[model samples]
Target: MTDIKSYMEEKLLQFEPYMLDRVQLLQAPDSLKEAMAYSLQAGGKRIRPMLLFAALETYGQDAEKGFDAACALEMIHTYSLIHDDLPAMDDDDLRRGKPTNHKVFGEAVAILAGDALLTYAFEMVASSKLYSAEQAVKLISMLAKAAGPSGMVGGQVADMEGEQKALSIEELEYIHHHKTGRLLAFSVMAGAFIGGADEQDTKRLETYARHIGLAFQIRDDILDIEGTEAEIGKPVGSDESNEKSTYPSLLTLEGAKLKLEQELDSAHEALASLNRPAPLLKAFADLIAKRNS
Candidate 1:
């Protein structure tokens, strides 16, 4: 009997210190360092990096080769969280059970911290030691597009603009796919690329990434409604309070749950094409679907 949770947690712990060390090595002013470290150290599940490692392992490659890319992804993600918590954005007060970056570091510093992380992430990708120059460029380009205006940033813009307005399912799906799904997809795709997976396998993994990413967001919406603050580590109903559209709001709670299951099924179907055991990937999908927080 394998405890997938503990397994993933151990895997997350493995490279986190590497990332922390990289952040510390930056020659920045104390305030900027503190601000950046604050949110970066404020840990979440480290799902993006873990997915990268898992995907690499799926193709019988050493996960260490993807470490730089994994760390880069996490940095981009952390920067997004910092920006998202700013007063101009979601205006969040708390994150992962603690005061948000802005709440602790002031809005201006928090914004700068996010900007620093975003730029530093590209530096990390460019300076990776394990990959060829060509591979590095590919990784850098993939991350930029995923985190750029065409992807997460664009989705955030749509989300902000969509507030107080009813969005159709197609419109909402676009938001979820681009905003959250792109990076997650990149995690898998990048991992596959590093692992020497064939094009067909990479495409299948992309489909898997899409399904899991949407399921992850849908579950987040469901948890916002059904999960307790203690469990979710933030105030529930904040979405409704912000008047933002959500899966539960759009599909109804029951409908959202059904959609979640359907997405999960679609994810598994995508995995079936791999013809290889993906215990971690399967466990990850189940975890996303069932997470209380």
Candidate 2:
């Protein structure tokens, strides 16, 4: 085994300074900057960027080459979380053991902080010196679509609409795939693209990403029901309180576990097709499958 937990921590430590450098206190008001930095620095697993770098390394590319793109991915992700915690969305209070952006900064400033991070992500991508112009354009387009209505935003809308309703498995899958899965897939695919992976390898990695992505969302649902706030860093049972459809709610806890296993198997199958070794990727799949928080 690669000791993936240690590797992940090393990579996170390597990347944090770069991330902070990108999120500088510029001409923007100190308050807005504070709000943006609050969420960015609060820190989660940073799994998306970790996946990007891991996939890049898998393809024999320098992870540093994808640095800007990795940071951009985290920015967009943080922006989404800030917005997701708003009163209009999931209305969350605590995030990663800290008050949400809206809780500290007011909803209006929180919204602007999210907006700032979203726009800054593009700026970082566009300014990437590592990629050629064509590569930059492609990466930018990939990110926009992944973050846009056809992807995460669309999924968010579907999730909100499906709340309080008993959505079919297919409908729930759609929401999970679009809302959470797309970005995760993008995280993996973005690395492949940056590393100039061949068409076959690209498709294979995408398949792995898709499988893991769904599994990630399913694990999230399981955690919401089974994890305590002290462990999860947020309130549990919010799903039932909001009358939201979840994997456990629809498929039963045992059934959801089975689905996660199925997805993990598919992910492994996809990785098996790749010519290169993927110890980190394999470890990541297991981590997502078995994560408690």
Candidate 3:
């Protein structure tokens, strides 16, 4: 597992130059460009990109072929974080052990940075040499749908609306599905499509991503209650402070842990059925459910 993590870190580092090069920082307004670079370069786990690479590896495809898709996914993820940390949203001041984008850049600049990244992500996908025209178009369409109103953005809206209000389990699921799950689902599914996975294989991978996505959020909720700021790189207990709907808020801490385990089991089962070895991805799912950060 440690070896896999190290390998992913190395691969992600290799992709960074090409990733940012796709966007013309010089063309953007100076302030916005600075802000975009700040947040986009901030050290994150690079989980989405890693998932894409792992999925490609599982399919015996060239991981480099998924590079553009991987970088585009990271761009979308970074944009979401910038917007999420705004005063109107999570109101967070820290991320990845550094000040949030809006905290360093003004709110306007942060918003613009996010907007720039979002649009640039599409540009990266469209212009990538990583896939055929048909594959690129399909990947772009899937990514746009996942990042757009019906996916991550929709989930963010639901999360904000549900705040300070009691939410049913189903409503909570809806929020997680769009907010956290869609991008994850897209990460795996896009890799499958790019790697030429068949319908049966793609469906299996989607199932795996969906279960782990929810479990990832559930673990996040638990971590908010149990993880330290030093470990998580953000203030702990923010969920409770904001009266946010979370797994632990609905279920006891122990119950939430149980649910997480159940989700992991389901995710693992789906992966196991694939019969294609994916130790790295499987380990990643476990890490997500068990991580302190």
Candidate 4:
């Protein structure tokens, strides 16, 4: 397989200027805009947008066709990270090896920045030249569902609630599926939908996303136990500190690792039916499970 990491990095660099320009165009208060820019530019993986582009390419679609949707995905993902680092939430001080948004911008500005990003995500999708009105509507609906109460937000709620409380394996899976998995799934599904993928292809992509989504969180749970602060760019063992329910909490270290491998394999199998080979997508699944950071 090609070097997926390098490929994704190249795409991220290509997308960065446009992403920044779009952020600057948001007509918000200066402080809020600055706060949003701070977090958005804080230098992370840009994995969500990369996945969107990869999925688009997998379907023989121009990556530019999904550019705005990719940007919207990044905005929503960044917003989640900002809120997650707040004192009221994860209380994280550092993100991407720098001060968290709340730490750099103050809590109020950070909160507004996150809000601005979330709302602006929809606007970006609505105004993009990439899709028809119908496609934009569908993309908007998918994104809203993935980011709202039924998806990422709901998972966040479950995650917070599960902290300090013992949870079943199924419950833990539910939390991950919503909290982290949904957006990842949405990223791929949105790409396929806007790329004009047929129903069968969309379903296969969804299956591929779902398996990798769960595996991604499981790998994260293991990473928290085994990875260093430098490797993860975040605190390790935060799950233990917060007494959060996680795959490792339920299955132990070795079991979680094995489960992650199983899910990665399943994801690859799902992708096998695609009309075109998705070497990058396959490599992404492997990288997510084995990532040190």
Candidate 1 collision pairs = none
lDDT comparison, 2 vs 3, better candidate: 2
Report the C-alpha lDDT of model 2 over 185-214, residue by residue, as the tens digit.
989999999888889999999999999999
Candidate 1: list runs displaced more than 4 Å: none
- Cα lDDT, all candidates: 0.89, 0.90, 0.87, 0.87
- Model 3, stretches more than 4 Å misplaced? 24-26
**lDDT (tens digit, per residue) of candidate 4 on 1-293:** 35886787678777998898997886767788788888888887877887788888887887788889988999999999999989999888998789999898899888888988999999999998878899999899999999999999999998898889899999988998999999999988987887778888889999999998998899888888999988888878887887777888789888888899899889999999887788778888888778778
lDDT of 3 by residue, 113-135 (tens): 99988988888889877778998
lDDT of 1 at 28: 87
Q: How many backbone clashes does candidate 3 have?
A: 0
lDDT of 1 by residue, 1-293 (tens): 15677777677677878988888888989889888888988967888988898898888887788889988999999999999988887788999899999899899999999999999999998988988999999999899999999999999898878889999989999998989999999998898899888888888999999999999999999989889999988988888897878999989999999999999999999998886888778888888888888
What is the number of backbone collisions in each predicted candidate, taken in the order shown? 0, 0, 0, 0
Model 3 weakest lDDT span, ten residues long: 17-26
User: Better model by TM-score, 2 or 3?
Assistant: 2
Better of 1 and 3 by TM-score: 1
TM-score of 4: 0.96
